[model samples]
Target: MVNKPVLPLSPIPKKWEKPLRGTVKINFDAAVSKTKTGFGVIARDSEGFVIGGGYGFKNEEMTGDWAKLYAFEESLKIARLLNITKVTFETDCAKHQ
Candidate 1:
């Protein structure tokens, strides 16, 4: 009998979904590096049309969770600047231990 090594499985990719009618979906993400932390957000209407988007970075080290929270806060500012009333926020960052 031959022995085989076990391998880890990759996570399944998820497709982006459109928001409900008369509402906008804001997706945000954060990237943390040794030197800086970066974040980006995009707002799309129910039809998947981009209404607004923004990206920013800070020259400071931060944790992944903190970066994600910062990204969420920035996204809210953008939404307010755009006068968006109905919004749905989405983020890919999971809770870290």
Candidate 2:
């Protein structure tokens, strides 16, 4: 097997943060259930415009590693639509990692 060089990703430029003023944060969580899977997203500005952003699906396809990857990819796509760059991503499956 040939070894391939792995290049690290450069950090997103700070310029992306210019449009955002004050402090803002968003949280994402996912709960996997047999009958249904649920994920929630909450966005809040320092001023407190708490937004309820979440979705739930009742299907077995919404479980396991592939499901998890899909969830993150979808979230990333949504984030790209907005001009938000600074984000905190937390996952409870840290140990399994």
Which predicted model would earn the best TM-score?
Answer: 1
Q: Worst ten-residue run, lDDT, model 1?
A: 3-12
Task: Kindly list the per-residue Cα lDDT of model 2 for residues 6-96, writing each as its tens digit.
Answer: 4334533322121145644555556666766666555555455753345545465455555566556555655565555665443334212
Model 1 vs. true fold: TM: 0.86
Q: Each model's TM-score, in the order given?
A: 0.86, 0.47
User: Model 2, which residues run further than 4 Å from truth?
Assistant: 1-23, 61-70, 91-97
Root mean square deviation (Cα) for candidate 2:
9.6
**What lDDT is obtained when candidate 1 is compared to the true structure?**
0.91
Tens digits of per-residue lDDT, candidate 1, 60-80, equal 999988899999999999999
Regions of model 1 farther than 4 Å from truth: 1-8, 93-97
Cα lDDT, all candidates: 0.91, 0.51
User: What C-alpha RMSD separates each model from the true structure?
Assistant: 5.3, 9.6
* Location of the lowest summed lDDT over 10 successive residues in candidate 2: 11-20
CA displacement after TM-score superposition, residue 47 of candidate 1 (Å): 0.1
Evaluate residue 77 in candidate 1 and report its C-alpha lDDT on the 0 to 100 scale: 98
